[model samples]
Target: MAKRRITQETFDDAVRENMEEFEMNPEDALRDAVEQFESQGVDLTCIVKAVPAVSSDDKQEEQTHEVLKALDSLRIGKDSAAVADVTADMKCFTEQCSVGFAQRYLAAQKDAYPTILSYCKKSVEEQDSVLTALSALAALTDGQPDLLDAEGQQFLLDVLKKHQADSSVTCVAICVVRHCCLKHEQNRQDLVKGGLLPLLTRAITQHSGCAELIKQASSALRVMTFDDDVRVTFGNAHEHAKMIVLEHNGLKILIDSATAHPNNTSVLSELCATLARLAVRNEFCQDICDLGGLKLIMTLLADSYESAVVYNNNNKELVRQVLSAIRAIAGNDDVKDAVVSAGGVELIVIAMNRHMTNPTVCEQGCACLSVLALRKPNNCKAIMENGGAFAAVQAMKAHSDAINVQKQACMLLRNLVARMHNYSQPILEMGAEVLIAQAVQTHQDCGDVGKAALRDLGCQVELRELWTGKHGSLAN
Candidate 1:
């Protein structure tokens, strides 16, 4: 049977009743409340289970800390609140939440979710209060996704629906939605069912000129396409991905947005990442290629690298995201050749060589090459000739401890040798055999792929047998 649970308000009311009516001490009251609830089979996991002190002289209530006190201040009748008071209280709550996770976790434990949610619901009509209240909610829900109940999800969708034309409000609302949907599967489902796809795509189309809004909207759209919730085993991530592309024209909107933000690397990076997320189907991958996505991505890749001379760190991320998008789009066979024909192989090799120290860039770079060389023997020769083979070997050596880099390098080596046997000897001459052996020895997950690469490169690999064909059980 499911366990019975009580709200923080109910438990606090019980503790107060024990102290004020029964003349019990604070400790005794707390103990009595705990024992009573446990005896009634009520779960106290989420309840704060504490009593605040009362100032007898002024009859004012004292909370555990300033954040709780601020939350308490906002709990008064919503209609009686002056605009100035609401603004100040929201700022205080938001500032406290911004300090650290300790304050945010405490506020969440003390039922601050409903209080701030109520403020958001009430302040929807007033523009200033709406942004202020939404900002507070955003800060509060940062690391506390569980606090986003169904009502909170509905409120977020309603905010987007009413304020779709208002860029400022829509940006803040999308920020909150991103916070809630990340790592929370149910919120993603609830929001999607509430018609979130069209709103997000429309926001991107309407605010294509606004870089900040575009980034936020693109990120929220990507979050919908993630299967990242830990509590639930299965999610409709693929369904959501398809919905975004097929039903909402997410491909065109994102591509157009990326085209609009030529100088803004951050916006371009986000759009590229979203593009990767939406390319879950073969047709979608072809659609991306059909929609001039390949040309746009190649342009962004070159532009971001050139701009990296001043901002290396920021542009490194852009490079990684762009490479990831390239890898995703290259899942199609025809697009694979298109990428190579458009100087993608040389550019990708250059990007990998430049960002050799960044493991993610190297990983994405090798994965992209592996996909490009999957069935095309000509492409494998191209990768080997353009210093692609040398780049992969150096990436493996530079970030030897990075398992993803090692795994992708192994896959790339295997793909290169899987079709053409001559290139393996040249690749093995680069001392790749030692790296493949080391990866197999260090990472258990890399055993199969590493061994396959070794075997394809004309190196000896041990084969293990675990099953005997003679029926029954091993014990028998």
Candidate 2:
């Protein structure tokens, strides 16, 4: 061969000639081009551009079909590198392709789902990576109800069943099932029947990795428990809640973890919220109250970190759940005294003041305060003495925009006036009359507030009747 000096033109012409041979295997061509660029120090981008593009309409469709087939095969393969590359390609294609291309790519690869599931089951160390890919795949098919048919649903359930004991796998499996359950009621049912609750209960006590896995597992359980089909499935959730509180020392662990990892707001919030739900009606409330659950929650609510904002939201929810728990346990005068001594009222007042803009927080804080107020008349008096009445009344008038907040505030006001009529004097001094007037005027627009304000007003009038023997006139 004559001495042919290599130039950019020569390299470009070589790549173009190879690319023009349509009979050549595309993967082989790509591999050869990559190797040539590596040897010649040529920019791969230039080589890629120089390659001939499939031009004929039929050839273009065929090339597209071939790529899809390759993706489907790679998705099913055991080769991690190949699977990762194909997954990346699929993700890019989904983002850049036409709707028709996306639909075909998703639908035409239904046969490969089993392989995907197998990869999920086999990739022990890379479980999170695989799960991330599975999540994306599930999202693609989420809008297509029939994309994940009975077979696909069954495959997911199989993975859950197989890896229920592996914490990492269980975490990913939960997310996969959660994605599948978004629009499919049947998949939701399948997840429950596949023993999700037992797995979650086990994970709550057993999963020993970073707290994130536990939190994610707990969150998944929470989501599953909300489904009507799965709600009844966790028939033992109440019993389990009691077990968590009494047997596992769950309240103590949650408090410690929340305090230690205050920066991991999501984990801390989930753990606390889960504990609160568990403590709902269990006799364990007394144990938890004795173990400082209330104090821990209050401390978190008072913290100034961003996590505190999360804790504030979750604390409001916990307060609602723990209200019944508080009533059941704090019925004892001594326990009631401890709640006050622990600064529960002051914390409630602070949460009310700080999170007034969050209606749920205001409602839950007010509800908890009402419980404390009813149980301990002295504590209620302390609240009034400390300007809580003004905050409560402010929440009632301004926060009336939220029905729950209005209801909770009205209920607290009613309890205050009913149990400690003496506090009503201070309440009136704090513009209680004006606030109540505003509430009555706007009550009709809010459901819970309207009903609650009417009930509270009637109760106050009824008390006046009982005291003075006059139905319509006040003793004054």
Candidate 3:
């Protein structure tokens, strides 16, 4: 007889003839066939055609058939090494397929998930790559979101707690727990009660080599600790922010990091800004001030070249963040004086001049200047004497075009004139009367500054005469 072609008929005949021998281990039999096909360069189309068709009564077999079909579609050619290359892709595809099957199977069988979970636990130990097994398990949990019944959830929690220290597993486990927590408030409480917080804290401290993992864990911890329910569960965890600031000497770290790696400007800026906001509370400001946060902020302002390049394209946010931090620090008199002594005023003035066309920065700079002026009346007077008042009044007069900038600049001017009526003298002397008269003329509907200018005019003897022009006519 002619040598039999290794078609589906021959393959099925060969399996049937040895059915009793391999009936106890069909998976092993399939693996052997797949390996043989690899070693002998057998035709997969014939082998695939030979595999017995799954019956409708066997849903698991049906899913396996679908998975095999998916695997076949990914086949590049009849090559064997192609099998190994497709392993990861096949695993991912089957993992997703199993999730939908598991959900439907659980609902149909009523207790299928727990049974499969138990089998998974027993077999996971013998698996060559536990990561793959764990990934499948995580997928099951995600798919049958409700499948982690109390016992199943406890089983998962136990696994997580047992391997919580395993850096490789911790990241995956944290992700699984994060997903679970997001599903419900009760799940969040369960995670905290199950000791996820301490696990995350330890991971952050121990996984120093894994920057991405540490960042993710830190982000998760931030979310959990700030969660309304978790907050009450882990009472006063927010207070730990202050402790981190103090213990880490976060200000110095931020300044050094930002200075050293200007590319990481946003990270450092956010850190400094967050610390500054936290420090604004009465209990923390003094400690922040004592920790040299004020000095660091002033240093940032003084060393403009360092931050300037990073902020050249987007100075508005950078300036606002820095100014906010400075303002927080400047709420302390000693810090304000330190800022001025560190040349903060001049740097701010330069930035203001550079960003004059950028109304938001102009407004922020004007506001900072206003703060400095309020803090140092002599500084306010000197600013007017040195032509700072003209720039401010010009910005204020142009408020109609950019209302926010105009409003801030006007408020600054109003504040300056209120603090030191003498400051208005130089402003009025520099044709501020013309600007104010024009603002009154153009923005008769302007509320705050319109009223403020009227009030300032009522206070100024020369401006009052200038407005009346010595004969009760508007200033020329």
Candidate 4:
């Protein structure tokens, strides 16, 4: 037989016969009959109204319950299948969920953080559990670190103290500390004063063989000592950060680590940054020199510009730290001579030209040059010969908003004019006087420096009398 065609009546007749034979529901028979028609050439959009629906609110409520259950699994001294399941869910939430989910979950789990802390606090021997707990804590506190309560704060410090021997634990603890103190100044002070500074240095010493651990410790130190306020904020009578420089032997630790591993530029950069942070005060600067910290930094800088190692770009940050540390150390005349002797002047000039747009580099470079030029005729001659005057003024104009750069440039120019012999002629040739006036007219903070520079050049500043009391820029 060729082909047999079935009408809608015939298909319905067959479906009804089958349904009666099978005792199927009449609705199921009709629906299956319609699906058979659709298999050929049917547009079901007109035939179907909608499919069955599930409640998203129900799913969300269930998920919320799961989160709550997970949090509950994190009770103190608890390590079971439930704890692992909760950890897995928390990991997923931290990694894949949104901030809304995090906030909601965190709000629901009133005791999760402390309980997790307590759970891990006793399991120092179980590195994996401790690591998991720490990672979970990090995820939970990423953007919500301010949610860390006083107990949680002390709990973290205790974790560090308890697990200081384990490099992995130390690494996690440092990461936790870094995120906690990143923008929270008071917390940073509390942790440091609580003896975290000395602990960091000791870790640096103990974990010299572990690159990752050292890197983590160095990074934590850098973050803690990063800000200007943190640099000056001491924890004890040791005058705050000076404890790091003096009492804790932080300077020596950094120097030794950098020397031990020359290729680890990340560690070197962070370590140098920590040193720079502590090198703010004169005693710290002198300490840096005494401990040969300056030499270490200068070597790192020279290496960045001269290294053939396949990863030279890694040293740019090291160069930045070196410049900043040198600027601070150069405040003293003895150290200034040492910097000049180390060819720091040429390096600063090169860095200035290389990083013409980086305001921090320019600021520190100019400040270092200014300090090197103070009361030193030969160093002034070096700066003048290397076109430092041109670089300084250009930096001032380029970053008019950078008060530090402007002040340093003004001071450098002032020293070049007043301290150096016959330096006024080159400054005039370099068109520095106009920049000086512009610097003063523009920056009220550095106006006195600008006017002093102008006067040193023997140029009658437009506001000559304003510098004394009528106007004040800033102290030299």
Q: Which of the numbered candidates is closest to the native, going by highest TM-score? A: 1
Model 2, stretches more than 4 Å misplaced?
A: 1-85, 90-129, 137-170, 177-193, 201-211, 224-260, 305-337, 445-476
Model 1 is weakest, by summed lDDT over 10 consecutive residues, at 55-64
Off by over 4 Å in 4: 1-83, 96-112, 115-119, 122-125, 140-145, 182-194, 222-238, 280-283, 308-314, 400-403, 464-476
The TM-score obtained by model 3 is: 0.48
Per-residue lDDT of candidate 1, residues 39-82 (tens digit): 99998765555676452455554435567777777877455784
Per-residue lDDT tens digits for candidate 4, residues 91-117, read 643443133433434432465666566
How accurate locally, in lDDT, is each candidate? 0.88, 0.56, 0.54, 0.70
Q: Candidate 3, overall lDDT?
A: 0.54
Position 122, candidate 2: lDDT: 52
**All candidates: TM-score:** 0.86, 0.61, 0.48, 0.73
Q: Residue-pair clashes per candidate, as listed?
A: 0, 0, 0, 2
Error of 2 at 358 (Å): 2.8
Candidate no. 1 TM-score:
0.86
Q: Candidate 4 clashing pairs?
A: 234-240, 448-473
What lDDT score is found at residue 267 in candidate 2?
70
Model 2 agreement with the true structure over 1-476: per-residue lDDT tens digits: 33223433455455545667745555556567657666765544312222334435676432323234444555645456433545665454334222343333333344444454445445434555555455544444533433566666665666666666666666656655555555455655565555555555565555544576667665654444343343243444454455545555566655555554555545756765565565555355566666777665555555533234454545455444443334444545566677677766776677677667767667776777776777567887877766666777888766756766666677677677666666656666766665665665676554344344445444342112326555675555
Of the candidates numbered 1 and 3, which has the greater lDDT value?
A: 1
